[model samples]
Target: MTNHLEGVYQIHHIFSNINYRFQQLINSSSLRLKIIYCANISNEILRFNKEQIYSLSLNESFSINLIDSLFIYLESLRITSINSNELLLFISNFQSLPCLKSLTIKLLQCDINHSQIYYEIFSLKMLKYFKLSIDDYSTSLQSSSFNPNKQMSHLEYFIIDYQCFLPSITNILSYMPSIHYVSLMKLFYYRSSLETNYPSIWPNLTHLSICLTTWDTMFECFEVLISKIGSKLKFFSFKNYHRNIDYFNASRWENLILKFMPQLDKFYLKYTENVDRILRDRDNNEETNDFTRSFWIERKWILEIEINNQNILFSILPYKKQWFNEENLFKLNQLVISRININKYNYFIQDDINRVLNFTQIYHLEITNENLFIGLLLQITNCLFELRSLKIHSLLLEDDSRDLNLKEISILYSIHLTSQIKKIYLRNLTNIKQIDFLMKFSPYLSFFKIDYLHNLDIPSILRQINHTYLNSLCFYVPTAD
Candidate 1:
């Protein structure tokens, strides 16, 4: 699925003698390392609880000859405890990494003037994605601070946070002419009286993700921010910790998105249980979960605002729709839902469900969650007439006594629509006794992979089933930690 990855090699600093061995092996390969992280490579005092830095000695005048050795072919690199006293010396070797596109830098402590630091960062022409976790909010970057000679035209994504709020951030962004994606970790840290008249600053920005401190401050620069950057944006996502649903003006927000972002997508809106009042009816406890949608769908393409406590990604797949035909809609074959958030009986509207139900070409389906399979699983099994490979992920059960839900057990009987089902992967699933219930759906099912097999009676259950059709059966017991 990914063409960018060629090979991955990681050297963890787990032992005393691994460092010398790592250097010896690194020189053996001529191929460039796309990603490299020498975890805890520094011998400095671990004052902060950040990821341990693994490099050379903590002496004041240490040789960075080792960094030059491995960094010659690195595309992505991470370094820790870079000398705060002599910051420029630490980054002098950065020019050697001509192919370096991504860098994550964390410093122990320092108060280097923001001008020099900002200049150094902008000078990296090839660097695209940079995470400035330096925790220094002070900035001397203004409208004129950017050097015309030092232009980062290739930079696309940046992760930067400043406590002074949007004014400071806006000052920095005014210089970056080609960045398409930016993660403003703190968009509203404090109120700013500074006004931004520059609209061209965010002209090329297509993907914008902001972590708002509160919705109260969201409306402060709401109109200005959206009016400037929203029109060209393809993807927009914002998440805050507050529990207020009133802050999100759905109609106004919809209009803004409609007017600004025309190239939207069909991604699901995933939210956690904390804001249940807005999406789920708390009072209504019926057989079906009363789920409300915050997204929109029209002509098979969807524009959505997703919220999740788990992992959230802000990405947009660009396609020319004018040259595309209607037949491309049915080309989907793989459907995967990681972190199953939907509970039983949770369903969408008739039209909404049709979008998913009509994906008849889907064969590889996957679902993973800590507990309770989504209600859509039943709908999928009942509707997907051609499902072949089914995979389910669940947490390890507390004890072997607990049994799978009755609704879960009944899926074997409802999988008649998927007559071509050949393989099944139940990964990290608890209660192996449930394997006995598969006698009904075992006729055409040949390959079975079951992980974390806690119960001892799984062998006896498989023996009961006639192995004439079952070609592969793998039962793995998890090694004790």
Candidate 2:
């Protein structure tokens, strides 16, 4: 019995079994004071055995009658799941737990007919964190009776997993005066319709995350939020498909950030499409040159080329020859070349190669699953002089692949271009020779990561390189066929 109880800090059971165990544990001192309980136990059972438990997680069927007994020992409670009916039943029960700190309620599947009672529950004086995860879309329209004007002095962290709604934001601002962190996930589109002034409501919030679709919508939503609370925001993250936009339009937000939130410290932007346009247009202004003008107009030409076969040949003609003198052509070509988007299997013209060689200020370069012909590789070797981080992703490996030769090029270029690189991440690198080459070139590199390299002798390579300055190394080998 002692051995059986040694590691058993938690017990989970159905209602009937919980009753029997509740009685048994109450009688036996050894089993009464367990740390956690997750079960469909009734309020009577929890009340009867209240003194022995420290943590409790009830199923949807948990009743409100248990609150009186549970609150007496609720300080250790960290997680809870309640349904609409249970919430309605337990509206008054919330005030019983003066020490309750964390609460998670499942309001997604529950009917909102009793949402008026929600406000009554928000009066909990000791609650610090609240997570409301709504599973159903229609439930968002239901207004909670929770009044915003009532002060929830202790509440600090609030998470709403649904669309952003005006009422929800207002209610939170009116209630939780101390909220510092807020996260909204799986937000629906309609919630953006809320017209409430933004910066005014969220003056105290410091950290925020919104998961939505499209960069345009995200920018608009952020504009609204910032117009009100931008001065107070310090950290921001946009996750999933919430803010999808073309690179050119997305870069406009830089001005928006500079204008509204001068104190902003951290920003993360990610998308699955081409980012070259966004990087190129980030500094666009009215005093642009012919080069910038031609670069800007070429996007229209590329789109036309995609739609019409006749323009493909003309579009394929070198833009440098058409734009400038032979002497200045190389320089203009390099500037325009960096602005061009790379699609599948396009041969690198001499201008493209020259552009890469001249663009020495590029600090981060990502070549992912794109075919880089030898000419392009040479240009990359020449231009990537100031690169601090390099990522080579999804390069295919054949028995006679050219990637095996990249290590030598990498070493030679790193020595000539600049020895500023401290991190290199290689994903799906199938060549061992390439690995050996990079090891020789970057002896002072601090971090090296290689994932999904086939048939590579990892241990032997580690022994050969024995990189003195390398602080982190990761290798993933494929299983035998």
Candidate 3:
């Protein structure tokens, strides 16, 4: 097997328990390996060609002493879940790997001073891309003087996957004037009166993504930072969890884009706020048209406003893609159905539903209607091109007096073969016939979760819906007995 796989350039080991011998591989000169190291291998320093391996990823915390035995001339290296001492040792070994251009470290150590880590990372003169994820909430940069000879990093890309304060990011950016791309997965704002404002040093920076997890009062500081560095951005994405009424000012955003961010080709904004608090402002009734201006229309950035579970979300994004997933199912379920319920009396009108819902953009859908009929479900599948996940609270048909006709059966069978739906959740299901009806149209379904199974033939349903993709089947058992 080793001889057969000697030509393999990329090797990814995802297993956690497999104790594969590293000595079996005699030729790993061109191998780009990703492995999860176990404690048993910590005592054995496995040797290999350190010069030819271009990339390596250690997915677990291994002995820091093993760093000396690993490849030194690696162009890219990723280490996950390392401690403070392990991080310090790795930093000491960075001096040996001058060819290392991309370095990623995910540190699990908490409640420790990360200032030294920050300093040593920036000292990597040849590094072009650097990403750090620290689990510690207090991962702030302490004041540390850089080496006089090595003042700045040549890094062109920087990313922080942890919640870091904006001031600390700005301080780090002061040493990375060559950076062109920056992504802050979670940015926080901790008020500090002594924090000094820095000028925009990254003249070549073009792409920026920031997810602000700060208090509402942090908007002012956030705006200041954007104004300084947002001028040259080609792509800008900003998401805020903290609600501020100022974020609703579309005119302000338009002005900022028109004046400062003229080079921006794409702009994405997701602002969420409490539904009751925002709707209380009656003056904002006409604010919906604020985003429909020529500026937004020219960019093809569609504006979608949704009210879900007590929160209202305002999103502005390009119309080229659908951003639906399991995490967004709760919101999409309400948004999609609300569009159909616009005319309360015409809820069952197929023509109105077809006109209201754009089937192409609707991927994941949920039907909470207690009075849903088989005809209405068939009408929905007629227009849907890429339906992925379907969750129905109750498919209790209003009229089960008749079975599907020849034409209806053909449509259901065609959808069963072509439909992209892989997940189905049935709630308040009381009959096996309803399960049989769903299984006919969802032949590709992989995940099925039923809310209840009182007196229903569960084994029969499972046998009837048996398929290779059916890996997950869940039922809610109310009692132990």
Candidate 4:
């Protein structure tokens, strides 16, 4: 059993007695184990000294004392099953990690005290990513005004998983001027909480997704919210559950998009069975609804709309070309062309890579399968020397044809010999044996969209990595019907 555990990376399902033998086992395993998915644990765990751990999804048993010892340099942390007060205390007390960037807190409850909760979040100056999820038993109304003026410069993406009233959402947005994406799992409002006089705005917000569960009219609520969104807004999504309003006028949405969101590219609308009719009618009127059919035809101004069953999507063609000029090109740090349409070849992206080769400062690059991305990588290696984030879709190690092999994988690694990519996203790679091969690069990757991970794979992948301060890990296994 000991020999079999030699290169293991995870110490999971562990509930044990702490003896000298356990101490030896821990010391032997400490060098490789970089992650802990702990269960019932005790203070004795402090004796293990799993030094390389950079990410922890800890339980309540790993209380404040254990936390103080373990949280020193962790880049990502998810505290499972804790109450709001405990979360606030932990965050407030956490005064010194200069590198902690991504944080996920799963609270068993919440408080309406917005200032206290938010102050701790904004206080983490280097934190760019944040996710807060509340348990089902949570009862906070979140009605109080969060009069916020402080600017959180590093805050970029914020996701709050609670049924919150709009004032809290709007107020929170007002404080996070640098935020790009805002996702609210659910939305609720009391009649009194809707203050007509309060003026708030998220100046840099680009994407917004919200869930609505109410029978009351949302038009007035939407109008107030939309008025605050100045032109940088691009995507807006509404997911209606438990209730459906009289069908929203298509013209109303279009007019709102035209007037308030000049740069809007896409929007989503979803609801229940009144949703049933919307789906069918949307399909029948697909072409007319599409914001535009061709970029050249409507290059000046016009949006394309399409329906994917229940989803009504609007596409804005050439909306990004205005950035092809010298001034805006400097601002193009993130480029995402990772979506692979099964039906068509991604030749357009190949052209884009060549066209943007003159651009020398892009920090993030997202590419799809090699049929669209292989050559682009070679071109990018020459131009973008400061690349920090690389997201690739459908990264398969094996294909029927003989274009790539282990040697090719090494060549791909050579391309990044000069760049330090901090975040990586890859999906749909079915070759199981290559997981170990990929593990060799785990030390270099701060974030991974490992959608095909299995339980047995964690130990080995984590074993060799002395995780960096920028580390974050995400696992996804596609659900079976």
Q: Give one digit per residue, the lDDT tens place, for model 4 in 29-141.
A: 44433455554453345445534456666765455544554445567767778777777778865556655778888877775475677778887888888888877635754
After superposition, which runs of candidate 3 have C-alpha atoms over 4 Å from their true positions? Answer: 1-46, 49-52, 138-150, 190-195, 218-220, 281-285, 305-312, 321-481
**Cα lDDT for residue 83, candidate 2:** 61
Which residue runs does candidate 4 get wrong by more than 4 Å? 1-34, 40-51, 69-72, 111-114, 147-153, 189-201, 245-248, 274-481
lDDT of 3 by residue, 169-262 (tens): 7777877889899999887765561255765678998999988776654555666666788889999998876776666567778877887788
| Candidate 1 residue-wise lDDT at 193 | 26
Clashes of 4: 9
Cα-based TM-score, every candidate:
0.51, 0.54, 0.61, 0.50
1-481: candidate 1 lDDT, tens digit per residue: 2432322222233443587776555534442322232336432222221122222223233455444533444566665556454566666667766666877666554466445666777777788887665544333112233343635446688776533256556666777888788887666633342265554766788777776654465444565576766667766666554443333444444565667566644212222224224334222232122112223323233221222333222111222242112133333234455433443434312232233332124545565545433334554554556666666775333324344456545665655544666677777545543454443554577777877655656656566557557777777866669
After superposition, the stretches of candidate 2 with alpha carbons farther than 4 Å from their true spots are 1-36, 40-49, 52-54, 59-66, 76-82, 113-117, 143-154, 186-203, 212-222, 239-252, 268-481
Number of backbone-clashing residue pairs for each candidate, in the order shown: 9, 16, 0, 9
Better-scoring candidate (TM-score), 1 or 3: 3
For each of the candidates, the C-alpha root-mean-square deviation to the true structure, in angstroms, is 12.5, 12.7, 12.5, 17.4
* lDDT of the candidates, in the order given: 0.50, 0.50, 0.66, 0.55
Whole-model lDDT, model 1: 0.50
> Which run of 10 residues does model 1 get worst, by summed lDDT?
283-292
Best by lDDT: 3
Report the Cα lDDT for residue 301, model 1.
Answer: 30
